[model samples]
Target: MSVSPGIDRTTLRTTVAVLVGGIAVILDSTIVSVALHQLAQDLDVGVSTIQWVSTAYLLALGVVMPTVGWLQSRLGAKRLWLAALTVFLLGSVLCSFAWNADSLIAFRVVQGVGGGAMLPLMTTIVMQAAGGHNLGKLMSVVALPTAIGPILGPVIGGLILGVGDWRWLFWVNVPLCVAGILLAWRLIPADEPGRRVRLDIVGLLLLSPALVGLLFGLSNVAREGGFGHPDVLLPLVGGALLLTAFVLWALRRGGEALVDLAVLRSRPTWSATALLFLTGASLYGAMLLLPLYWQQVRGTDALGAGLLLIPQGVGSLVSRVVAARLLDKVSPRTVAVAGFALVGVATVPFALAGADTPIWLLLAALLVRGLGMGMVVIPLMAVAFVGLERPEVPHASILTRIAQQVGGSVGVALLAVILATAATSKGSITSAFDIAFWCATGFTALAVLLAFALPSRVGLDASAGGGTPATGAPPGPAADATEVGKRASIAS
Candidate 1:
């Protein structure tokens, strides 16, 4: 049989099953970011109360991630995923019917609870099923929601708000969740629950509150008095102390810790997690800045800004197949370096962009920026799992995701602070944005140097249960890969 040049059938089906349900969670974020004003007005609430709509979800997500490994071992992947999906569906329905501000905020916590578990578990399940094969290709598939959600969410939100009923935002998730449930039930292979792991109650007490405090603090950074504000400073300091304590506690426990800090000992795992933090900060900072430039500088509405950002998303989509194919030829270091270079170079156009910059020119740069953004995640994930055991994959997923999310909040907070300060100093909104974009570009440039730390052409010893991460191109198709796909097709 001729070898296929993509993810095999079994993996593809599982990917689809997870992504169908997962897309709504991601889209919900960007979609809601655009609709905050509308929500505040419709709910008859102030900015602080409505801000919780987003902040509550983020903190809830952070709180649940550190415990995902224990949850998966206790509940099994299939059941946990189903339960999470069902809860998210229920939350969406409740949110649609919410009559008051408090009701919506409370219902949002329900969504966040379900969403928090879903994000990391989605990766753990898919990575386990992929079984350490063709990971670069797999990430291109795995990273789909990340790529498309930012692209489509705003556009969808704009269209929905255009309909004048804010509740449709929640209603929109119903059909997707229903389809995801049916597909997951039918397509994902079933597995017996693993041996029950003892819960790390102390670690949970330290870490969950640590994440919540830090994120909640950062969420307040863009507002009055910046980081020095009492609300921002207090949570940040408290979060840091708690996080430091959790690190010490986790070190003492090793594999027994709630999050298994031992995974960071591997070269690939630590490097990828650190690099993902930088990229997450940069990418998310840029995501925040791009639409703002259009709205504030160019005078376009949210919908028009969303429409223009499509080329970047398209560029990311175009790069996946090529980047996956390239991993078969070069080290992940090469791909990462090249990708960061594209991101850094592409960002230059934005730093230089003025109110009068040609629309077509900016659009072209977005396409390149997207290509680079797309390439970064592939190698980070491809490298991270290189030396991990099946059990270790869940911990690594939880760790990397938390790092990225924290990094994202950090990025948004830092950049927002900078923009506010910049705007005040010169009263030149244009110059303030230019400075912020340049800083965004600086973050990507740092990532390029760090990319060199990623292990290149590392050879895996499959003799042990742990395989070398597929960092180099494989010699050819493994004897079992096609057979696995065939079996998967037949079974489903």
Candidate 2:
């Protein structure tokens, strides 16, 4: 009944049920990306308008992420999760039937609202169920969807497009949601109606807009004027200001604020958050470029690029077993440092590669990149939950989740600007890609240094955090941005 230390039947069952539901949310993020062109053409909408199909979903995620912890307190895990999943199922059905770009965009927002809750809630539910033992192994299992969704979604989307229509994208989620709903209802232990925690309307107002500003700002970077454009600059500035205000409010409000800042007092949690940002850049910023590099420079189609990227996903899959085992013996610091180093070293091929750089070599490098990414991510995700009490799990999840999500957005946006400027100044697209890849390497390099700051192993700082609501200093890193530029997967 136990898969490993502390992994019992209930824990394993919970993980499976959560992942089944979560995968629908994660896959839907990237599956629609490749179908944008098709949707635009079919709907008789401009590419710019059709793009909202993705953008509205992304912005919805950004807005909803911070409120998850509060919502969990109000609804209890079982009830909240089902409500969110059902909402996503309804949104998916609505999306398939959408008659116009406007309707589709609205439907996507509905899906994002459900999805935004599920990812963070997935972590909280499983970690709470496990009670914080054998985290490395558990995280490897928990994070599988994040590892596979973005990589495989495009390939699935391409094939669906080849054989069917774009609406099939939403239709695909129907079965998964139904299965997830049934499994959850049967397997998950039900809880009493949750506590009567008051909603922090003021904090919600400040934090939601702040996240929206940041995500919206970053999303605008790929448009004209790059980072300098008002769309990009204004939101960045406004989000930063509002985020600052929210932190000050949370400090005063203590645990009553929409998201309690006390969990960040733990060194491991905060430090891992910062490194996750860099890893976000390494994971997502590079993802943005890799497929484009192949498509534009090597003249491959979307499907071909997705196929070539699979080795990287495979490497991540391969590393999970090794990473889980290593975490049992080695320090998270050692595992993370080595992982970042390998990721940095592996990125060299892409940075130095020319147009004709052998396909096999690039694929080989991708495999290594995936391996390193897996190693880095496993520890980063697991280390945050160390020593925390069950109640605080949601708070920690929100902190780490938001950090990576924001980080991914920042990473994707930064590289987009860097690539655009470099192309203009260097007058060579490949050279620009090279420069951007080096910047990504620089992210891993920084992450390596930050990884050293993580607790050498789990429980080293458990006494300090003690997993209480008011334990740590105010939160430091937010939104280790996940999703592709689709907010990427923080999987934290």
Candidate 3:
């Protein structure tokens, strides 16, 4: 089962297969961002109704993510993933045939359920197969969609919309899905299913509704004047209380509850999760700023704006190899602190750029910002797993992903609020853009503080995290409990 050293053939093949599938999910998630307007018109619905398409997908995804650890243990990775892919494909087909906004949004729920399962499962599968080694390089391979999605999704959506129709966006997923299924079948390992364990039905019900209500509250806050509105306040407060309840319930269960919160006691886990939130704020905040700045201030069309983003994507892709290598050799703290500093510095140019700023200069700033982004994402992810047990990896993966997704939503909402208020008083698109850029800079600066929380030095073993001493699992009815406990110990 040992993979050979230095990008072994089997590892490379498996990594590529997993990543190809990942690209489809990530791409589809973001592609709809650029197509919403077109979709509303084609379906003859108001923009408000069309908004449900993305929201439903996001809500469904968030609800399902925390369940992934249990699903993998019970269903096995291959079966769960293949079932997810089948659901997603069917959803895509349904979406393409939708005659109304409501139908499309409803179908997107199906897609989201499938999509939600795939992301964490992909991370769990790929990282586990790497045997808790070479996390940096493997993350780089996996990080492709995060970097490329912003570029590809918008551009592809714009191109397809310009030449044909909004349905083409869904159409694009077909070929990729087919290829992914085949590659997954051929390359992914088919381990025997694990023994059945008690499913936390109560914990899942509590968590999912809480997450949806929270996200809904936040979205409503963005829409209905302010957070003080009853619609916003009720759900937001209720959701927070529910989440708190889940936490208490989980802790009372002695860490065997849904999320395994005990793992947060691990310094690496806490630090990594914190950095994940900051990274989400910075990365997603900047993504919002660049495009709006181009279209609103510089008057670039959708395609032109997408073209301007190319340098940023290129910078991210180029940095991956270097960042991956540096992570294995350098201290995670040192790498992350420097990365945030670079991101903060790069934001200054955009914050100060005028409508007349030269294209080349803007592109250069994006390239620098993108490099910092890659550095932040890859290392933050790599350092988070350091000293984790194999079993805890899935839980950690789910938490990090959830944190980032929520952070992104917050970042976008905050920026939107800022831009809205600023535009009224500032009186110019450039002014709004500059104000938002400064906000983004602040987010990156905060990331530096979180980065310092990571281990000050590297080269730590996966099983050597600073926390409670390791303990074997309590006896369970299932035969696989021992195996699960060993894996969970490493991750915990």
> What is the descending TM-score order?
2, 1, 3
Candidate 2 local lDDT, 1-492, one digit each (tens)? 446664677778878888898889888877887787788889998755876787788888878888888787777787888999999999999999999999999999999899889878888877766666667888889879878886788899889999998889999999999999998887776764445568899999999999999988887777767778898899999999999999999999987888888878877788887887788767888888888788767889888888889999999988988888898889999999999998999999999998999999999999998999889888888898786666677888887888878888888888877877777778788888898899999988988888889987575224322232221112111221212322211110
lDDT of 3 by residue, 83-151 (tens): 888788889989999988888999999998989899877776766666556677777878888888877
lDDT of each: 0.80, 0.80, 0.73
Off by over 4 Å in 3: 1-5, 460-492
Q: For candidate 1, lDDT tens digit of each residue in 196-297?
A: 778999999999999999998988887668889999999999999999999999999987889998889989899999998998788887887888788778
Looking at model 2, residue 338 earns an lDDT score of 93
Q: What is the C-alpha local distance difference test score of candidate 2? A: 0.80
Clashing pairs in 3: 387-462, 388-490, 389-490, 389-491, 391-487, 392-491
Off by over 4 Å in 2: 1-6, 460-492
Model 2 is weakest, by summed lDDT over 10 consecutive residues, at 471-480
Q: Per-residue lDDT for 254 in model 1?
A: 82
Error of 1 at 206 (Å): 0.5
